[model samples]
Target: MHDIRFIREKPAFFDKALARRGLGSVALQLAELDQRRRAAQTAFQEMQAKRNEASRQIGEVKKQGGDAAAQLAEVAALKEALGTAEIQEKALGKEIDDLLMGIPNLPADDVPDGKDETANVELRRNGKPPVFSFAPLEHDAIGERLGLMDFGAAAKLSGARFVVLKGALARLERALAAFMLDLHTGENGYTEINPPFLVRDEALFGTGQLPKFGEDLFRANTGHWLIPTAEVPLTNLVQGEIVDEAQLPLRMTALTPCFRSEAGAAGRDTRGMIRQHQFSKVELVSIAHPDASAAEHERMTACAEMVLQRLGLPYRVMALCCGDMGFSAMKTYDIEVWLPGQNCYREISSCSNCGDFQARRMNARFRGAGDKGTRFVHTLNGSGLAVGRTLVAILENYQQSDGAVLVPEALRPYMGGLDRIVPHV
Candidate 1:
């Protein structure tokens, strides 16, 4: 959430930032609401003062043996007016709060200005797209041909945008997730965590996924929301918390099945796990001191890139434009892995620096040495790599003409020493 005081003090700056996201200025509307809220607050305070004075005057009249009826009536009237003002003040405050929660984080100064991904800038590329002896089939085609990925069964059980990984394919998915978790925890200094797959509304709100993107979530009948990403829970671990500055950089990683409605993603990548209702991901989150967030952002991105590097997968890092950033991200870097099947790059991970945007929403703060005040800690999250997408990359990049898939050397141990996945038949 944005600081209302900051917006009030510098409406133009806020509006200009919004403009870069292809949004019209909300500054004027917000200012009007703030003004009304202040006016209502002032009225309530004045009425409160009047009520106190009337009470004192009434007591004096009674003590002096006067009727005191007029003063009593005046006090009663003031109380009624004060109650009305209090309600108005509360309403106006809520209005302002709602508005603030809806506003996306301001793009950092370095973020490129654009309306969408078309304007994203490529930062760097790694490795090379594998040479194919024959035309590479997409992940789904490879999985289906191997008779382990069953989309028909998935659809029968859960409708569209779902798939069931059987036998070696299922093991491959699990191996990918385990590989990512081990890499992130052992090599990247991230503490491995297993978080709840279901969370509360406040948790989602704190992560900037509520009130605006609720449509993209899966809400249970019991009111708990199926997590869209492990980041939601990992980053929210410090919600409503105050930490000592000595623990400034808290890094956590989790491998979990993420559930999303994909409400607005209809018809895109409908054929494969690329756009699925449920998929596994190894997520990385960091709570860092405000001064350290920028460096942490780069470090986090590198950690994700390392996953691809170790797998020998060709990928590129993209600096997302302002308009393409997530609601909670001040800046984002998308790591797109080359898909031989698609003959192009597809996003496999997104690393973002929220720059206190989420911390403010969660009221997560840190107390430093010699500081009488607390400051919000900066939050960052990234996909160490989406497991399903990683599996897709592996299958497409390592497929042999005879339909066998060579296992990446790093994952062979997790695959029980299996070197390749061949058709069961």
Candidate 2:
């Protein structure tokens, strides 16, 4: 959340940030809300004070054994006025909070100002795109031909945007998740966590997913929302707490199944496992002090890139344009892996430094050793990598001309040292 004080002090800067994001100036609307809410609070408090003083006058009148009828009636009217003021105060406060929640985080000054992915600046490209003398098939064509990916079965079980992996394919999917978790925790210094798949409304709010984008989530029969990513649980672990400064950087990682409704994303990536209603992923979350977030963002981005590096997959890093950035991120870096089948690079991981936007919603704070006050902890999250898409990339990129798929050297042990997958048929 942008500090209201900051917005108040620099309305033009705030509006300019919004314009770059393809949004109109909200400075007037937000400032109006702030003014109205504060006005209500001031009116409410004045009336409350008046009501208390009136009651005291009535008490003194009765104690003097004089006529108290006039004073009693005045007290009743004052009580009614105070009640109305309190109601208005509560409503205006709620409206102000909703307006604040709708505003996206301000982009970092260095982020390029542009609209959409076309304007996204590529920071670096690594590993050469694979070469194929013969026509290479997409992952869906390769997997379906190998008698492994059973989209037909998936359709029967759960309709669209889902897949069923059978035999070695299913085993390979599980192995990818385990391999990612081990690498992140056992070697990358991230503490492994087993987080809840179903979280409360506040957890989503803390992660800046609620109040907007509610349509993109799956609500359960009991009203609990399914997590869109492990980032929700892992990042919210320190919600509403004051931590010691010594633990300024808290790194946590989790491998969990994420569910998204994809409500607004109807026609994009409709084929295969590129986009899905359900998928497993390894997520990395960091809670860092303000002074450390900038450096930590680079470090976090590198961690995500490491996954693709180890798998020998070609990829590039793109700094997202303002309009293409996520709601809670001040700055973002997307790692797009090269897919030979698709003949393009697709985003496989996103690392972002949210600053204190989430911490404000979560009330998550930390205190320095000798500080008199606590400060919000800056939060960061990245996909160590999306396991499902990684599998698809592997199948498509490593496909042999003869319909066999070779496993990368790093994933060989995960796949039981089997060099290649053959058709089950």
Candidate 3:
């Protein structure tokens, strides 16, 4: 959420920022709403003060043995006026809040200006795409040939965009999650948390998922929405909390199943796990002081890159442009892993610096040791790696001519020292 004071103080600057995101000016409308709300609040306060004074006068008149009927009538009238004023004030305040909540975070100054992924700027690349002796097949074909990935069974159980991994493929997915969690929790300074997969509407709203992207989520009959990412639960750990400045940056990680309805994603990546309704992912979230969030964003991206590096997968980092960033992110870095099967790179993880956008929504703040005031904390979340996508990259990158998939050296230990997965035959 945006600070109304900022908009009031710098409406032009705010509008310009919105323009960069391909949005029209809302600062004017917001300021007008704010002004009306403030006026209503002042009127309510004035009427409340009058009512109190009138009640005091009524007491004084009664004590002096004078008729207090007029004073009592004035107090009653003031009380009714105050109620009306208060309602108006509250309504205007809600209008401003709803507008602010719908507005996407302003892009950072350094972010490139453009719309969509085509405008994203490539930052850097790690490792080289592998050269294959034979034409590489897509992950789905390879898995199906090995009799380990079954879309038919998944279709029977669930519907489209779902896959059932069996035997070694399933183990591979589990191993990827384990490896990511270990690297983030053991090596990186993130605490491992097993958060709930289903959350209430408030939780989703706190993370900027509800009220705007509700159609993208899966809501249970019990009214709980399935988490779109671990980012929701992990970041909200500090919701409505006021932590000491000493704990400026609180890092957390979780491996959980993410569910998406893909309501807006009609006919996109319909073939495989790329855009699945259910998938496992290792998510990273950080609650950092505003001053340190930029550095923390870089560190978080590096941590995600480390996963690909360790697994010997090729990938590149792309800095998302203004219009390409997520709803809650001021800036974003997407790590696109090279997929031999697709003959292109696909996003495997995205690390973003929210710059207090979500903190405001979550009401998460931090207070300095000697300061009486608290400021919203900056929140960042990234995929250490999407386990399903990582698995896809592995299957395509490490496939052998003999129809076997060599396990990445980093994941061998988790796979019970297994080096290769042969066709089930």
Clashes of each: 0, 1, 0
Lowest lDDT 10-residue stretch of candidate 2? 1-10
C-alpha RMSD of candidate 1: 1.9
Q: Write candidate 1's Cα lDDT for 1-425 as tens digits.
A: 99988898999999999999988999889999999999999999998888888889888988899998887888877877888899999999998898899999999999998999999999999999989879999999999999999999999999999999999999998998888989999999999999999999999999999989999999999999999999999999999999999998999999999999999888888888899999999999999999999999999999999999989899999999998999999999999999999999999999999998999999999999888999999999999999999999999999999999999999899999999999878
Rank candidates by lDDT, best first.
1, 3, 2
Tell me the TM-score of model 3: 0.97
The 0-to-1 C-alpha lDDT of every candidate, in the order given, reads: 0.94, 0.91, 0.93
Candidate 1 residue pairs in clash (backbone atoms < 3 Å)? none
Which residue ranges in model 2 land beyond 4 Å of their true spot?
54-74
Tens-digit lDDT track of model 3 for 184-294: 998998999999999988888888997999999988899999999999999888999999999878999999999989997888999977889999999999999999999
lDDT of 3 at 345: 98
Better lDDT candidate (1, 2): 1
Worst 10 residues of 1 by lDDT: 71-80
Clashes of 1: 0
